[model samples]
Target: MKNLCYTLLLLSSISSFAQNDSILNFQDETIYRINILLPGLEIEKDVYKDFSVVGNLGLFPGYYKNNNLFSNSEEGFFFIPFIDLQVRYYTNFNRRIEKGKTIVKNTGNFVALKFTNYFGTATDHRSTESVRIAGMAYDIQRTYWDHWHLNFESGLMANFRC
Candidate 1:
């Protein structure tokens, strides 16, 4: 009995020695930058001199920062990925005609799609765990001179814990 009691006491003391009674600030700080190149192509071209395809390449870059209430000891790093795509079409036509002059009007349409994924770890001084989130979104717009315009957008999101 005495040996068992002594063993238990020693184990308890060793565990306590691993912990310090110090106050700690828990927060996460992230400084990140990313860039993306998106290309859009019009399957068919009707307004250009030649009935060929029209396309445009777009480049965009941005920075992001986040400060979490928890620090590294109790916090984990994050990994995020995002993408966006856009397309536009433009056309011009004569609205009115006269013997010597003519009036013209402009019309255009646009579409966009976006997606994002966020995954990381969340920790409390002792152990770190993983967290993940995902989402997808899309948008469309159309316009015509002296006519009705239309716009549509939608999104879906999901969150996971492990």
Candidate 2:
């Protein structure tokens, strides 16, 4: 009876060791990833001279570059070509719009109006050209703690090309 009990104990120990050894010898594999997507953006300043704003106002004028397009080379190589442009903006504001709820309480509000224009061609061969005029006007009224809010907005949008 003693020999039988000892034999059972040894078998159980050997089985446990074998299970642990199998786990230790397991090899981890690496995953390979390929990305074929391309996106780009560029901004240039054409005019940045100081301009007077009767009320609280900020003015920015510059060039805009958008290269969000990818061009495929003849050799199956993918490349991104950048498009250049002139952009101008004029705006006036009553005050700085507060963003998000305030730490102290719910009281926060914001209003803004801006006009933007874009001029340039994105294609290297000048196959396409575009001119755009756009405007945005927004107003938001929020509670003292800013968790809830009401908003009113309207604007003009246009695009012209030749």
Candidate 3:
């Protein structure tokens, strides 16, 4: 009886160290997105306490409008390959936590500097030149029903042809 008591006491006294992360100030994860406007893979990694860097490789599908007198206006599916990167600063982590909101999956308001490179535009007549665009934007991200991610962003982008 004494030995069993001693063993139980020793086991109870042993320390177990683990991360309790009950309250999160920021998000750290790699997200695979295919059902959004930009379908691709992206990862958001922490660069500072509230700052993170994200990279994406995806396909851009849109319309091509031509305004030339010699040629007719043809509206066809234009699919282009692109790569994008962003430096994001999450601005509402503490506020969301205070409001009893779940901060899982990086859902919050953020300001980001975004950069993207287009390999080429796909159209009836293809262009061999590439384009680069850089911009800064305010973004809002949210998850609905735990799986659907909705995002909205608005900003000015400058394009450079190369």
Question: Over the stretch 1-162, how does candidate 1's per-residue lDDT look in tens digits?
Answer: 999999999999999865232211111211121222322211223343211222222222223344556853233343323233223232212211212221111122222222232323233322223334445444343433433433465667566564
The sequence of per-residue lDDT tens digits that candidate 2 reaches over residues 1-162 is 999999999999998754233222212322121212323332222133211111111122333344434763322222333332222232221121222222111112323334333333343432233344444443333332223323344545555443
lDDT of every predicted structure (CA atoms)? 0.33, 0.32, 0.77
Query: Model 3 — TM-score against the truth?
Result: 0.71
For model 3, the run of ten residues with the poorest summed lDDT = 15-24
Better candidate by lDDT, 1 or 2: 1
Determine the backbone clash count of candidate 1. 6
Instruction: List model 3 lDDT by residue over 1-162, tens digit each.
Output: 999999987876673332225534554555565546776767667777678888888877766566788887665566678898999988998888777776777788999999999886534465545789999999999977767888899988999765
Error of 1 at 73 (Å): 14
Regions of candidate 1 where Cα sits further than 4 Å from its true position: 1-53, 72-91, 96-162
- Global lDDT for candidate 1? 0.33
Which ranges in model 2 have alpha carbons more than 4 Å from their true place? 1-109, 125-127, 139-154, 158-162
